[model samples]
Target: MTAAIRLATARVGDLAAVMRVMDAAFEPAYGEAWSGAQLLTLFALPSARVCLAWDGEQVCGFSAARIAGPESELLLLAVDPRFRGRGIGALLMKDWQAWAAGEGADDYFLEMRADNDAVHLYEQSGFSECGRRPAYYRGNDGMVRDAITMRRSRDRDGED
Candidate 1:
């Protein structure tokens, strides 16, 4: 199943498909999903990049990031629930890091709800916990969750 998945640069026409994947991937209680308009705003940024993963004709995953000088932030990443565990998330992370590096980014950052299991995937991709905000995310159910910030520095001749 993983073999059939392909990653490509996201096009404006792919917005709807990306939204569908976002809807399926994010649990409503977490209030983590971004609106289509918000995503479109990212598309207008010169430094922003969005990648989409497709399985046949279906959009299964996506990742969005933006770079500023030597720093880059991963704004969003999601894989459809039906496509989880097939390495799509890892693929997205790898692609984002490469894209950022190519765009002159040396430090990469991402923040997520502390309880998110995707932390494991980010860690595997070389991101480590760098900071945290207590009770940062207020969920739809009025429950708060910590937001953890993770960072990965490109190894420049063994120096981070």
Candidate 2:
């Protein structure tokens, strides 16, 4: 966070760097970090887009989304643990929305662990809880966790 961070559209070649960020951002106890093969498959999808936040040559954070019709679903968002609390996560969210808007998205949605503390951050970003799925994830501790779906309506005019 000491150095200024810049957001950029991530290229296919950046997959490894983005996966590294995902690994560093998610804890094993949470069982939420995505595998490289999974990410590689997503990158190959035409509906998917990946964006990266860079501090010099290093990727501090990244976000990915799937766009279909007028709807966009945030598939993943992560910031390196060391870079957290520095506003990188919020930046990634904003960038993701902007990109979605430019792609003609009018409805944005995302789902995450119900107990995730980041819920407040999403609320502040204009998302509202729209639905929930019970026992959607089984954590490493062998406890089941619920998933909450949050959504935000974007104007077709494209204003963030």
What are the lDDT figures for the candidates, one per model? 0.92, 0.88
Best by lDDT: 1
Against the true structure, what is each candidate's TM-score? 0.95, 0.93
Model 1 over residues 1-160: C-alpha lDDT tens digits?
4789899989788899999999999999999999999999988899999999999998999999999999999999999998899999989998898898888899999999999999899899889999999999999989999999999999986333
For candidate 1, what is the total of clashing residue pairs?
0
lDDT of 2 by residue, 60-148 (tens): 99998999999999998998988889888888888888888888888999999999988988998999999999999998888899999
| Span of 10 residues, lowest total lDDT, candidate 2 | 1-10
TM-score of 1: 0.95
Superposed by TM-score, candidate 2 places the C-alpha of residue 50 at a distance from the truth, in angstroms, of 1.0
**Sliding window of 10 residues with minimal summed lDDT for model 1:** 151-160
| Stretches of candidate 2 exceeding 4 Å from the true structure | 1-3
